[model samples]
Target: MGRGRQKAKHTKIARELKYDTYNVNYSALEKELGHPGDDQYVDKWADQYADDDEELETA
Candidate 1:
């Protein structure tokens, strides 16, 4: 497609998105926001490469 046509199509989509509103699920949002006792993340690769990381830091 021509550049002008592509630009006009983008402008139309942008205008529609700017004015449109949709329903929000507040309960899901709250759940995703945070929860206590949810800090169980573990990076096994970082742990495995601990010696290499220390060598880089010292250099």
Candidate 2:
């Protein structure tokens, strides 16, 4: 194919992809990831390192 034609085809495909809307299935995603729908997820390690981080910041 010619360079101009190839470039035009790429641009058309890119425009179509850019304008496409994706429908996200959150319930299915959560089930696939084994994550409960509860939003109270907490990081245990963050709490353990909180004091050490504050000490470094003061120094």
Candidate 3:
């Protein structure tokens, strides 16, 4: 059985290139990087992950 929705795939490059949040379009990024359809595509990229621990600390 499938989860109904697709599980986003992240590329090593994207992971390294941290964004402000997890709401980015990895497919577009991949195209920009000249590696279209290379099995690393995310649907979101938000900035919340930037200061992960800091945000938690403040909270």
Best by TM-score: 1
Q: In model 1, which regions exceed 4 Å deviation?
A: 37-59
lDDT tens readout by residue for model 1, 1-59: 59999999999999999998978999999888765466876566875665876799999
The per-prediction CA RMSD against the true structure, in angstroms, equals 5.4, 5.8, 19.9
What tens-digit string does per-residue lDDT give for candidate 2 at 1-59? 59999999999999989999989999888789885468677676875575777899999
26 Cα displacement, candidate 3 (Å): 0.3
Best of the two (1, 2) by lDDT:
2
lDDT of 3 at 9: 37
User: Against the true structure, whose lDDT is highest?
Assistant: 2
Total clashes for model 1: 0
lDDT of 3 by residue, 1-58 (tens): 3433332334545665685356789888877877436577654665445657887898
* Model 3 deviation from the true structure expressed as Cα RMSD, one decimal place: 19.9
Winner on TM-score between 1 and 2 is: 1
TM-score of each: 0.53, 0.47, 0.22
> What ranges in model 3 sit over 4 Å off?
1-20, 35-59
